[model samples]
Target: MGELIQEFNDYRAKMNDVILGKQNKVINRLFNLDTNCYAEGALSTKTKEMLGLVASMVLRCDDCIKYHLGKAHEQGVTTEEMYEIFAVANIVGGTIVIPHTRRAAEYWEELIAQ
Candidate 1:
């Protein structure tokens, strides 16, 4: 039991570190306050989450996809809603992004399982 608890704690710590690093990279490098329009936009939190998820899917960013997907779920996005967003992403970004997003989703499933 102690071993199991330690393993879980280690997993949580690693996950937190990875997520924080990814967020810092994105926010600092990609989003410049005065120049980057994503920072100026007044979109609703839900809309922003949806757009971020779509962008992650299109860009084949696995870490971004997992983060945004988790955010979307926390913000009350349903599976059907995510599917619709994916349909739009596929239409906009082509077939390649679809498989990438699917792979990211699978990765998330594996993470949750562990």
Candidate 2:
């Protein structure tokens, strides 16, 4: 894995373990919901991840964007499809999203490079 990707995953994992270990009901439930929501259903996992990526980008959450990008890549979202997702986010989010799109594109490239 690319160093950037590996570092992100490692940090996320370590933090998640620490956070979840605290055992707050609300946080745990929210985490559980997030996990279950992305499972395959009428919308495929790839489709869900694509939607997540777009939403994350528009919302300007860098961590969410990276998480969804990784998931989207794992679920076989193509580079072309990622561009379309980026377009949708930009259209919805306007200029504010451009910076995030740049980061997202860079992260996606890192993902593909590994």
Candidate 3:
């Protein structure tokens, strides 16, 4: 992995472990819920991930955007599909999300290069 991608993943995993180690019921439950929410159901996992990516971008959460980008990539989201998702996010989020889109594009590149 590129240094940027490696650093992000390593830090996220380390922090997640530390956060979950606290064993706070609320935080654990939230984490569990988030995991379950992406499961196959009414919507396919791929579709769910696309939605998540869009929402994360709009919310301007870089970590979340990265997480969803990884998931979306695993789902075999095509470059074309990703561009559409980016368009939707930009339209909904306005120019404020352009900076985030730039980061997301960089992250997706790392994922693709992998």
Better of 1 and 2 by lDDT: 2
TM-score computed on alpha carbons, candidate 3: 0.97
lDDT of 3 by residue, 1-114 (tens): 877788988999999999999999999999999999999999999999999999999999999999999999999999899999999999999999999999999999999999
lDDT of 2 by residue, 40-110 (tens): 99999888999898888889999999999999989888899899999999999999999999999999999
Candidate models: Cα lDDT each: 0.67, 0.94, 0.95
lDDT of 1 by residue, 21-50 (tens): 677866655445412443325776778888
Off by over 4 Å in 3: none
Instruction: List candidate 2 stretches off by more than 4 Å.
Output: none
**Could you tell me the lDDT of residue 60 within candidate 1?**
77
Q: Using Cα atoms with residue i matched to residue i, what is each candidate's TM-score against the true structure?
A: 0.60, 0.98, 0.97
Residue 96 C-alpha lDDT in model 2: 100
Question: What would the C-alpha RMSD of candidate 3 be, to one decimal place?
Answer: 0.7
TM-score of 1: 0.60
Of models 1 and 3, which has the larger lDDT?
Answer: 3
